[model samples]
Target: MRVDDFDFELPPERIALRPASPRDAARMLVADTRGLRDRVVRELPEILRAGDCLVFNDTRVIPARLEGRRGDAAISATLHKREGPRRWRAFIRNARRLRDGDTIAFGGEVQAVAADRAADGSFALDFAGDEPVEILLERAGSMPLPPYIASRRPTDARDARDYQTMFAREAGAVAAPTAALHFTPELMAELDAAGIAHETLTLHVGAGTFLPVKAEDTDDHVMHAEWGRIDAATADRLNAVRRDGGRVIAVGTTSLRLIESAAGADDVIRPFEGDTDIFITPGYRFRGVDGLMTNFHLPRSTLFMLVSALMGLERMQAVYAHAIAGDYRFYSYGDASLLLPA
Candidate 1:
């Protein structure tokens, strides 16, 4: 399908700048082959059945945005994907000012020298000094907020806690697994009481997730690789649930992607630990997830395409239009949707 096939009119006001207070208070739009239903995120437990396995991506968002100076010019760097220790692929402001071999000092203590420019204008950076990059980033980096949030303010103390999910454990993701953000401890306990099981898989969200689809046709787009891991224990648990005829509900697109990437064509999931660049567009066959709970995505984005693959383009468009007409929040820190394919 064409990239334009996924396009929709999203009002600027609809883009959520702040998350809903209490998180679970965010609105939810449930879509299935039957029709659409508007509900609150807190109503998820009642919507799902017992014996269902909810798979979550436990990837933690790193404070990866950093401000530094290349000589006298101020540069803002957002660590996209990690390449090696002290090395990263980053999106920088004023790329023309910096070139290969130019050292950019981060917070006047640690420095990273530009190595090269990737085709997409992202920079390959290698840090200076003996200190590990992780250590330096921990000290100097700030939360990498999405660009739609026009507030140029620094990530405050509240963002440190609010931008992440309750189950975030593993590090490396630049973006949060947003669908998991609505889940609170109370909700988890409720699900547990209802006999619903939850398992975790990690997919360090790459900056590529936010990148727009530049291709004219969806099929021409190549997804960016992100490291992910699903341990044997979680695999065993998921398999057990599947064997018992339980539905596997993915909490977010990241978890769904990772599971589908690791699953065979026959729909059996396996233990996997590696990088994946799996792109799911409309017409792609799904192998793993039976249902999805996820945040509303941007227009013409790969994530929207993935959801379209789950349902259909026409149906997704209708749902999105309904969301817009109903004044539902959009994007990260926005509302969510629970999708069950027919």
Candidate 2:
């Protein structure tokens, strides 16, 4: 299909600069077999069935955005993927001034040597230190906010806390699974009392999530690989849930993609590890997840295409129209939607 098929106009003011206070106070647009319903995130326990399971991405957002200099020229890089213990692939801002073997010095004695520039303009940055690269990032890096939000305002201390979910533990992701940002301890307690089970997996969200679909056709767009993991125990439990007639609802696209990646033709999920560049579009069959809870996405984005695949393209178009008319927030720091297809 033509990429233009997914396009829509969004007002600039609709973008959320800050997350809702108390997290669970954010608005939620629920789209199901019945119809669209406007609700708040705190009411999730009431909205979802008791037998449903919410799979969350527990991958923590690393401080991946770095500002440094090489010979008086300022350069910015956002580390997207880990190539090795000390090597990372990063998208650089000042590529015109950089070349292979140039050492860029970041503050606090952190520096990296750039090499092997890819056709996509990313570089393999090998850090110059014996200390762990995580430590180097701690001294020199800031949270990698989505370009839409960062373009409007600067990243700050507040994002350090706000961007991460309560389930964040294993660190690697450059971007937070924003849908889970609405979840709080109180909300979890309510969900527990309501008998709605929750599980976690890891998918280190990369900066590629922020990239736009420049392709004229969906077939031409290539998704960037992101590392993810699902162990045997989790897979067994998820299969058991479905085996017992429970629904497996993924809390974010990250979780959904991994689940679908691990599922067989028979719809049984299995253990998985390593990189996944799964590009979900309309007409795709969803085998693993019954429903999805995700943030409002950008126009013509792969995420929108993924949602269109879950629900019908016509239905999601209507869903977005409803969301926009209702003044729902958009993007990473924005409001969320629950999509359950009939």
Candidate 3:
């Protein structure tokens, strides 16, 4: 499909600078088979069935944004993926200033030797230090906020907590699964009391998630690979839920994509772990996820295309139109959407 099919005009004011105080206080727009409905994040449990299960991404957001220098030039690097115990693939700001075998000094904390630049412009940096890379990062790294937000304002201490979801535990992702950001402990308890089951899988969201679909057509877009995992116990339970007439509700596109990747042609989910470059588009069939809870996405973004695939493109267009008019927030720190397709 032409990428233009997913384009829509969004007012600048629709972008949210901060999330709602309680997280669950954020507004939610539900797009289902019946029609669109205005709601709040706190009311999620009331919208679904008792037997339905919510699949969550447990991958934690790492403090991946780093400010450093190579000799006299200032350099900025956002670690996208861990290559090894001491090496990482990073997207550098002043990449032109770097060369293979140059040392980029992070600070007094540590230094990394740049080598092996990827075709995407990201470079592999192997750290030289006795301390673990995580420790060095703790001293030198800042939250890797999305460009839409970071360009507006600098990342502050608040982002250290705000950008991380309550479900964040396993540390690997450079970007948080923004859709899961709306969830709160209270909301989870409510879902439990309401007989709504929830399970977790890990999908280390990469900074590549921020890359634009520069391709004119969906067919030409190259989706970046992201690491993900699903354990056998969780997989068996999820398959059982579906077999017992329940629905699988993916809390974010990350979990949705990973689950779909792990599902067989028979629609039975299995244990899986590794990289997934599953770029969801309108024509792709969704076998694992029955519903999705996600954030408002950018115009002509891969995320928007995924939602359009779930609930027809025309319907999502209308849903987004309503959301914008209703003053609902947008982007990584925006309002939420609960999408249910028939």
Candidate 4:
């Protein structure tokens, strides 16, 4: 299939720029083999069965966006992936003006030397610091919001808290596992009362998640790798649920990808920790997850393709159209959806 096959018309106003005030008050569009149902995020516990297991990505989003000056030229940078304690792959704005050996100063507290350029136009920068790069980023970097949100100025304090998930624990992801954003403490209690068990995994979302597919043919598109891990305990719990004839509900695409990557041919999930470049599109057979809770995705994006893989392409198209017609918010900060396989 071609990348254009996933394309759709999305109105500019439908793109959500902010999260719902109460978080759980966001709308949810439920899609299954039968049809679509309009609902709210708070209705999750009532919608799911007692034996269903909810899997979530515990990876935390870091302040990865930075503003710096490269040899007197102002530039914007977003750290994509960490290579070492001080080395990282970063997308630098005005990268064309930067060259190897050029030094960039960030917030006047840290300086990084441009080492090399990757084929995708990303730069490898080596920070001049004995402290870990993560620490430096926490102090100098800002939240890396999606490009669709046009900031009138620079990132403010509100974005620092709003863009992050309430349940964030382990630190690594550059982007939040958006589906988890709808969850709240009260909603979690409701799930517990409803007998739905919960487990956590880790998938450090990378900057590549936001990259557009430039290939015409979907098969020719190369997916950018992201680090992920499924621990022994989580693996055992998921397998137990499957053996008990319970549903494995992945909280987001990140969790779904990690679990699917760890699934063996024997139909059991195994402990895994490594880089994954799994590109899920329509016609891909799901191996681990029985259901998915995810947010509305961008038109023609890989995330939309992944959701289409779970639900049929035609069904997803109809669901998206309904969402648009109903004036439901879209994207990371928008509403969510609960999808069951046909």
How well is each residue in 1-342 modelled by candidate 4, as lDDT tens digits? 888889999898898888997999999999886688999999989999888999999989898888999767898889888888788889888998898899899984988998879888889899997888788888888888887774534567887788887778988888889999998999999999999999999999998999888899889889989999998988999999989988999999999999999998788999999999999998888889998999889888999999999988878898899999999999888999999985
Of the pair 1 and 3, which is ahead by lDDT?
A: 3
Candidate 1 structure lDDT: 0.88
Which runs in model 4 stand beyond 4 Å of their true positions? 150-154
Q: What tens digits encode model 2's per-residue C-alpha lDDT throughout 194-308?
A: 9999999999999999988999999999899999999999999999888888899999999999999999999999999999999999889999999999999999999999999
Model 2 residue runs over 4 Å out of place are none
RMSD of 2: 0.7
Q: Give the TM-score of candidate 3.
A: 0.98
lDDT of 1 at 176: 92
Query: What is residue 171's positional error in candidate 1, in angstroms?
Result: 1.2
TM-score of each model, paired residue for residue:
0.96, 0.99, 0.98, 0.97
Regions more than 4 Å wrong, model 1: 150-154
Candidates 1 and 4 compared: the better one by TM-score is: 4
Return the lDDT, model 4, position 134: 80
The TM-score of candidate 4 is 0.97
Clash count, candidate 4: 0
Candidate that would win on lDDT: 2
lDDT of 1 at 292: 92
Q: Sort all candidates by TM-score, best to worst.
A: 2, 3, 4, 1
Locate the minimum summed-lDDT window of 10 residues in model 1. Answer: 147-156
What is the Cα-based lDDT of residue 94 in candidate 1? 87
